[model samples]
Target: MDSKNYIDSGILELYVYGALSEKESMEVSQALQQHPEIRAEVEAIERSLTQLSTAAAPYQPDQVYQQIKTKLNFKDQEVAMIPITRKRTNWPAYIGWAASVALLIGLFIQFDKNKELRQEVVQSQIEKNLLEGKIQVAEEDLTKTKTILSVLRNKDVIEVPLQAQQVAPEAYAAVYWDKESQTAYIDVAGLPTPPPGKVYQVWSLKLDPLTPTSLGTLDSFNEEATKVFALNNANESEAFGITLEPEGGSESPTMEQLYTLGVVNS
Candidate 1:
C-alpha cells in the first residue's frame, strides 16, 4: 500500500492503543519497519495516546518509578554505564573537512597560476619570433649596404668632387664613377633642397663640344636619408653636372639652373 493508504487503514491507531491481535501487530510492525514514514506516524500516534493516558490519571506516580526500579534491582546503582561503543572525537571530523577544503583551494590556485604561466610562455614565444623577424630583415639590409660600401672602396674606382655652381652655390656633391662597371654613385650630402615642383637631374657632359647627355633625375632627393643615389653611365664622359628641372626632368640639361659640375679624372 501507498503511505497515505497505509495511514488511512486505521491499523496505526489500533497498534498505538495496543488493541491489535498478535498477527495484526506483527503485520503493522513489518509495515512500520519497511516504511520509515509509516513508522514515524505510528510513533507520533503512540506518543499522543501515551500523553492522553497520563493526563487521564487522577494521581501522578511519585513512587511508581521507584517501585519499578526496585523490581528491576536498579536502585542505588554505583557503577556508571556507557551507552555507545564507538570512541568519537568531536573536532577531528570538522578539522579533516576544513583541511580537505583548504587543500582543494590551494590546488585550484596552483592550477590557475600554472595556466597563467603557460599563457605567458606562449606570449613570450610570439614576442621572440617577432624580434627575430625584425633582426633578420635588419641583417639582410645591412648585408646589402656592406656590399655597396666594399665596392665603393675599391682602388680602381675614380672619385670626383662636383662643386656647387652659380645657380645654387651652396649645393655640393661627389660622384664615385666606376668606368669598368659603367656605374656612378653620387653622394649629394651637401646639396640644398630643390625648389617646389622641381627635381635635380644628372647630366653626362663632353667638354670638347659641350655636348650633354641626360642620365636620370634624382627623384627621391628629399625623401633619401643618406642623400646618396646610384646611376648607370656607360658614357665616354668628361664632366658631370646637376641641373634643376621640372618633375619628369628636361630632355636636355637646363644650364641656367645648374647646381654643380665636376670633371672625371683621367
Candidate 2:
C-alpha cells in the first residue's frame, strides 16, 4: 500500500493503540521502518495522546506522587540519564514480597491449628456423653440394689430355706415371705439359667393329700442379676417347690422337673 493511502486508512491509529494482532503489528512495524512518513505519523499520534492524557489528569504536587511511592516502599529507580558505578538491586521489593509470603504461611498454620482444635473438642464431647451414659446406668443399678436390701431387712419378712431336690442337687434357694403383705421373694442364686422357651414355676403345697397350688412363675431367670424374684402368694402354705416348665406356667406342678423343695417351719 502507498504511504499516503495507508496513513489515511487509520491503520496507524490502530497500531498506536496496540489494537492489532501480532502478525499485523509486525507488518506495520516493517512498513514504518521502510516508510519514514508512516513512522512520523505514528510518533505524532503518540505525542498528541500523551499531551491529552496529561491534561485529563487532575493537578497534584510532585510531593503527593513521591509520598505514594514512599508508602508503597518503592526504592530508587535506575536513572538511565545519569551514569552509575554498579547496577543496584531492588532490596525493598524483595523484602516486601518475602514479608507477604511469611504472613500467608503464618495465617495458614493458624488456620490448620484451629481446625485440629475443633476436631479434638468434638471428640471430647463424644467421650463425655458416653461417660455420662455409663454413670446413669450404674446409678440405676445401685438404686435397685438398695431397694432389694431394704425389702430383705423388714421385720415382717419370714425366711425359708429351700434344699436342692433330685432334679438338680446343686441348686438351693431361699424364700423371704412377707407374711403381712402376702409377698414372697425367692432367692434363686444357686439355680441354673433355664433353657429358651422354658421357665421356673413355684408351687405352694399342702401336706395331707399332697395338693399343689400355682404361685405364678419366675419368668426372668436369666436377666435377674440379683437372682431374686417377687411373687404374690396368699395360700396357707405348708411347703414351697420350684419346677421347670414351658414358657407359661403349667396347669399343675411338673414333679419330674422339680429343682428344689422347702418345708415351711411351724
Candidate 3:
C-alpha cells in the first residue's frame, strides 16, 4: 500500500494501541524505519499517551525526585529511578505474623485428626453391630439347647437304653419317654455317623404281636453335634429299634439295616 493511504487507513492508530497483528506491526515498524517523519509522529503519539496516563494517577508524590534521590544515595552514583520497597523490622509485628501462621497450621492439623477419628468411630460402630448380631445368634442356640436338656431331665420321663445290633455293634443310644405327654427324646450321641444318602429311623415295636410302627425319621444324623432327636410316640411302644434306611424312612423296619435295639420292661 502507498504511504499516505496506509497512514490514513487508521492501522497506524492500532499499531500505537499495540493491537496490530505481528505481520502488520512488522510492516509498520519497517515503514517507521524508512521514514523519519513517520517515526517522529509515532514518538509524539507515545509521549502524549504517557502524559495522559500520568495525569490520571490519583495523587502525585509529595516529596518528588529529591526525596527519592535521598533514599537511593543517588546524588553521587546517578542511579536510575527505581522504587524502594520498605522492609519491616518491628519485633511485635513479626511475632504476630508468625503466631497467625502457626495457628492456621495447628487448625488444619486438628481438622484432619478429627476427620480420622470420626472415620474410626464409624468403623468401630459397624464392627460392634456385627459382633452383637453374632452374640444374639449364639444366645438363641444356647436357649434351644437348654430347653432340650430340661425336657430330657423331666421327673416323669422313662429312661430306655439301646444296645448296638448286629449291623452296627459299636453304636448305642438312649431314649427318654414322657408317656403322659406322648413325647420321647432319642439320645444318639454314642451312635456312629450314617453313610451318605442314608438316615436312621426309629420304630415303636409291640413285642407281644411283633408289630412295628413308624416314628419320625432321624435326619441330620451326621451333622448333629449332640446327636439327640425328638419324636412324638403316641402308640404303646414295648420296644425301640433304630434302623438305617434310605434318605427317607421306610414304612416298615428294614430288619437287615437295624443299627440299635432296646426293650422296655413291662
Candidate 4:
C-alpha cells in the first residue's frame, strides 16, 4: 500500500501503543526504515501521546487540531486533517485480565471435583471392612455348629434321658456320657432359663444308701447359646440328678429343689 493509505489504516497507532504482534511490529519497523513519510508519522503520533499525558486539562479536539496545524505550519485550506476520535481502548490489558480470571475459575472447579472423589474412595473402603467383619463372624458360627453335630452322632457315647421331677414338671434334660473320656455332656435345651443369682448343679448319686456327691454348678447357663454343658464326672455314679442352687452351689444336695433324675443303664 502507498504511504497515504498505510497511514490511514490505523496500524501506526497500534504499533505505537505496543498492541501489534511481534511479526507485525517487525514489518512496521521495516516499512518505517524504507519510507521517510512513515517514520515521520510514527514520530508525530509519539509526540502527540506524550503531550496528552502531560496536559493539565481534559482534551479538547478543536483546540488540539489548531495547535497541531499551526506547529506543522500548514497553509490555510492546503492540508486536510482527519478528525481524531477521543475515545481509545487498551485491548491487550483487558484481554490479559480476562485470561487470569478464566484460569482461577478452572482451578477452583478441578479442586472441588478432586475432593468429592477422595471422599467417595474413603467411604467405599469403610463399607468393605464392615462386610468382611460380618463374613468372618458367620464362618466361626458355622464351625461351632458342625462340632455339635459330630458329638451327637457318636455311637460310643451313652445317652440317658432325665425325667422331670415334682419341683419342675415341665423341665427335662439328657446326658451323653463318654465313659472312656469320663466327660458328661448335659443337654438342658428343654429347661427354662434360670433366675438371676441361681444356677443348676449336677450330682453323682449312689442309690443304695442315697449318697450324693456334688459336681460343679452350671455357671454360664444363660450365656450358652446351645443350652448344653460339659462336665467332668470321674466318680462311680449309679444315678444322675440336677437341682436348682445358689450361684456358687451348696456343699450338699438341695432335695427340695430337685428338677430332674435318671438312672444309668448297666
Could you tell me which 10 consecutive residues in candidate 2 have the lowest summed lDDT?
Answer: 78-87
- Per-model C-alpha RMSD: 19.2, 15.6, 17.9, 12.6
Candidate 2, superposed: residue stretches over 4 Å from native: 1-22, 25-133
How many clashing pairs per prediction, in order? 0, 0, 0, 0
lDDT of each: 0.77, 0.79, 0.76, 0.80
- Cα deviation at 123, candidate 1, in Å, is 12
Write the residue-wise lDDT of candidate 3 on 72-135 in tens digits: 3456344333223322223334445676899899999999999999999999999999999989
lDDT of 2 by residue, 1-266 (tens): 68998887666765665545577778999999999999999999878755644445433334433453465455557223323223223333555567689989999999999999999999999999999999997897798788679878887677789999998989999888888889888889989999899999988899898999998898878877888888899998888999999998999988899999999988
TM-scores across all candidates? Answer: 0.51, 0.53, 0.54, 0.49
List pairs with backbone clashes in candidate 4.
Answer: none
Instruction: Please provide, for model 4 over 1-67, each residue's C-alpha lDDT reduced to its tens digit, 9 standing for 90 to 100.
Output: 5999898767786577654567777899999999999999999998877566544335344555455
The whole-model C-alpha lDDT of candidate 4 against the native structure comes to 0.80
